[model samples]
Target: MAPKVLIVLSSHDHFPANGKPTGWYLPEFAHPYHVLKDKAELVIASPKGGEAPLDPNSVEMFKNDPVSADFLQNSQELWKNTVKLADVLPKVNEFDAVFYVGGHGPMYDLHYDPTSLALIQSFSEAKKPVSAVCHGPTVFLRATSASGQPLLTNASAVTGFSNVEEDQAGLTSLMPYMLEDELVRVTGGQYVKADQPWGEKVVVSKTSNGAVLITGQNPASATGVGQEILKALGVN
Candidate 1:
């Protein structure tokens, strides 16, 4: 049997401006899902049990690409069968890994969520690979390891959607807070950036205990992020 992997996505569906639909970026969820599904039994979950919003910009011709467009059309069916985060009775030992997929929505909903925080802590304590990409890292801002230390405090290597990308997307003024900067500040984690915004892939840092925490810079990094997670899990 393939290992089980839990994939968490944001539930928020409204963009600040005019209540436009926005949630997980299509590619971020699609690319990773395809890769992982090939080798694992993937479970999709969100804070709420319903349709996950897709960023409008991510559906544009340039952004949709082939794979993402296919995923978007099928996402509803996929999510309709997803396990709600509220309903997840994690054993912490049943799953091989956890991955957080992100869009601007996660910045608002998942960041301070108590349940999401608890899931991360539980998975980390169990020594499962804890992975995130794009704004997904926001979930870690409030998560703590089993030892009572902030999960990311002193975590030297980490990455996330950069301020530059937020600025370029014209959403810096709209978001409640800056994700990359705030994460670095609160956790005191040594945050790093790519040469250009949205151009780089995921970064994985192995803890001394062999647990892996991985992050991606933007949608461009989604596939690489999934690959890293598979590698960490020792899946082909």
Candidate 2:
């Protein structure tokens, strides 16, 4: 049997009434799903579970992308199969990897979620790959190693929605905190970026033990992020 990997998504759907858009981008979720579904047994989970919200902009674009449109057509079935975040009592030793999909929602929900933190730490402790992207890294802000050091601190390379991208999206003023800056500050890990907005792909940082932590800049990098995860899993 192929190794199983858990894919955690944010439960948040709507942005504040301020009219700013948020939630997981269609490509971010769909691209990874397409890649990993064939190679690993994937278990999707969310903080609140049951029908996670899809971003409106993402939905609009999904209609235009054949791959995404197909996924949406099967969304109901997908939701039915998803394991509730609370129900996923993940034993790091049992899974080969854990992937946290990002959106503005993660900044609001996953950042302080104890279960989410435990999942990441458990994966790290078990020497399994732990992957996240965009604002998904927010969860790491509070995750620490067994030694109490910040999990990503000086251990892995990381990236997220850059300050430049946040500013462009006009969310810099509304969000509770900046993700890119905080990741670098808290972990002292080197943060890199692509040259253009929404064009950055995945960057994988490997530990001496060969465990990999990979991150993508935004939705555009989702496919690449998924591919990196496959590579780390030793899949061709």
Candidate 3:
């Protein structure tokens, strides 16, 4: 049997400040799903479980994409039946890797969810691959190593939504804190980015202290992040 990957998505669907609906970005999940579905067994889970919200904007972004079509056409209820994150943490050893999909929703929940912190820490301590993209990196804010040191303290390079992009999106004031600056200034990780907005930039590196991590800058980098995960899993 192929290795199993657990996909953890944020269930917080409301944008607190403006009360706008927000959830996982479709492309981030679809693109990676297409890449890993054939190579590994995937289990979808969420903080709250059951019908995790899909960001309204991502619906239009993926309207014409085949992977998106597969997602929309999926009648399996895989996404609809997402298990709770709290339940999965204890069985972390059953999964070969764990992937956190992104959306602004994570800023509201996963960033501070205790179960999320445990899941990430569980994967890291097992020396298994832990991947995230865009706002998904927010989970790292609470991830720590077995020794209780910052898990990303030795990461060579990590990328996520940059401050410039957030500023360009005109959501700076709306967000609790800028994801980019929080990762760089607060988390103390070496955050970097692509030159152009929405450009595809995937960074795969082993932390100086030895941990396999793969991160993507934005939605466009989703597939590449999956490819990196395959590599980390020793899949061709």
Candidate 4:
């Protein structure tokens, strides 16, 4: 059977800091979706269920990118008919992996959502791959293992939306906390980044217990993150 992957999206439609419109980033989801669509069975889900919003700025910024544009046109139903995250938590064993798609939106909701955190813990306990790209990794900021230890404590290396990238975007002050800084502090400097800002960077960290954590630095690293997930799942 094909590996089943749960694709988690943020249901938040706006940034709490300023009430500005924000949702999952287009390319972050689109690029990774295309990469895994052929090899895995994917189920879309979110915190609040129903239609998950897309970041308007990301849609506009990546409109010219063919893969993202095509996904926007053809994959609307996927995001629109999302299953409630809490409902899926009980069925965590049904999936082989869990992937978090990033946008500024997750920083508001999934960042602290207990249900989402629990699901990540479940996946980790099951030895299934837990992966995210860009701001999506923010959800891991609070996730813990079944043993009550910080989930990141086991990660030897990880990467996410970096402090430099956040500053470059000029939206650092608006975020509740800097992702890179917190990740570094949590993982004891396990956080990694690309050589330059906005460059593609994907890190695969395997915990001592054999749990896999795959992370990407930014939207540009989404595809690479997806590919790493497939490899982790033993998919050719």
Candidate 5:
């Protein structure tokens, strides 16, 4: 059988407070999907199980890129075919890895969904590679192991969308909370970002039992982050 990868996308279609349209970033999924589809069987799953939403801005920004163009061309086909997070939990063993594709929408939905948290813990407990990029790391906010400790408590290294980047984007005032602060202060995670905000940063950390975790900093880091995930999974 081909090695299988579970790609989790946010089901949300808007940002929380402002009610602004937002969803999964196209490049975050497209870049990695293009690389991994040939190497593994890619399964797109979402909280709601059917169609996942795409952030409007990302669609405009990446419309010209070849990979993103393909995603746009096939958006209807992709959205029509996602599986539920619940369905994936029972068959977690069938997957070689689980990857969380990121966007502002993830902060609104996956960040607080108990099922999403359970799914991440399931992959971790199974010793499978778990990969996330940008705000996709938001899914980890509520995940914990069977031992009762927070999943990221004092982890060697991790990176995600940063506070300064939020400020740089001039949307810090709009989000529910600062992601960088939550990772460090609330989750007991050691948050790391590039010297400058939004730079390509990836952190590959392993648990004592050999479970692998790979994280990327932001949208620009999406392609490199996906390559790192492929590497961690032993894909050529």
Candidate 6:
């Protein structure tokens, strides 16, 4: 049987800082989706269970990318009809891994969402890989291990939407908090980033508790993150 992977998306569609519209980044989700589509059985899900919005600007910016454009056109229904994450929590063991796809939206919701925290915890407890790209790693800011340490604690290495990248985007103030900073402050794990902003960077770490934590630094790294997840799951 193919490994089952649950892809979690943020249901929050607007930024709290400016009330500006934001959702999952198109490329962040699309790139990974394409990478794993055939290699694994994928499931789309969100906290609110329906119509997980796409960051409009990301849609516009990545419109030229063939994979992003293709997913935007053909896979709308997957995101439009996400399963309720809470509902899926009970059956978490049925999957081999969980992936979080990011945009500005997740910084506000998934970080503190009880359902999301519990779901991530479930995956870790099951000794499954938990992966995310870009702002998706923000979800780990609050997710804890069986021993109640930050999930990233003692992770071999970690990466996320970096402080430099956030500043370059001019969204540093719009974010709830600097992801790279908080990731380090809370976990004490090595938070590394690409040598250049917006460059591809993926880090796959085995946490002290034995859960695999995979993270990518930006949209450019999303596909690599997916590939790493497949490798970790022992999927072809």
Top lDDT: which candidate number?
A: 4
**lDDT per residue as tens, model 2, 1-236:** 88789888887766664766667667778878888988998888888877766677777856888777878887555644556776775455668898888878888888998888877777777788888877877777788776676777665577889999899877788888889888778767577778898786678885333357888888788888889989888897
For candidate 3, give the lDDT.
Answer: 0.86
Lowest lDDT block of 10, candidate 3: 204-213
lDDT of 1: 0.81
Q: Write the per-residue lDDT of candidate 3 for residues 200-221, one digit (tens) a residue.
A: 9999865433669888999899
Assess candidate 2 and give its lDDT. Answer: 0.78
Ten contiguous residues minimizing lDDT sum, candidate 1: 201-210
lDDT of each: 0.81, 0.78, 0.86, 0.92, 0.83, 0.90
Instruction: Look at candidate 5 and tell me the lDDT of residue 3.
Output: 84
TM-score of each: 0.92, 0.90, 0.95, 0.98, 0.94, 0.98
Q: Compute the lDDT of residue 28 as modeled in candidate 3.
A: 90
TM-score of candidate 3 on Cα atoms, chains taken together: 0.95
* Tens digits of per-residue lDDT for model 1, 1-236: 88899988888888675676778777888889888878998888888866666677777833538778777676567765666786774555778889999788888788988888888887887788998889988988788877777787756688889999999888887888898888789657578878988797678874333468888888888899999999988888
RMSD in order of candidates: 2.0, 2.3, 1.5, 1.0, 1.7, 0.9
Ranking by lDDT: 4, 6, 3, 5, 1, 2
- The local lDDT score (0 to 100) that residue 148 gets in candidate 2 is 75
Candidate 6, residues 60-137: lDDT per residue as tens digits?
Answer: 999899999999999899999999998999999899999999898898888889999999888998899999999999
Clash list (residue pairs), candidate 1: none
Candidate 6 TM-score over all chains jointly: 0.98
In candidate 5, list every pair of residues with a backbone clash: none
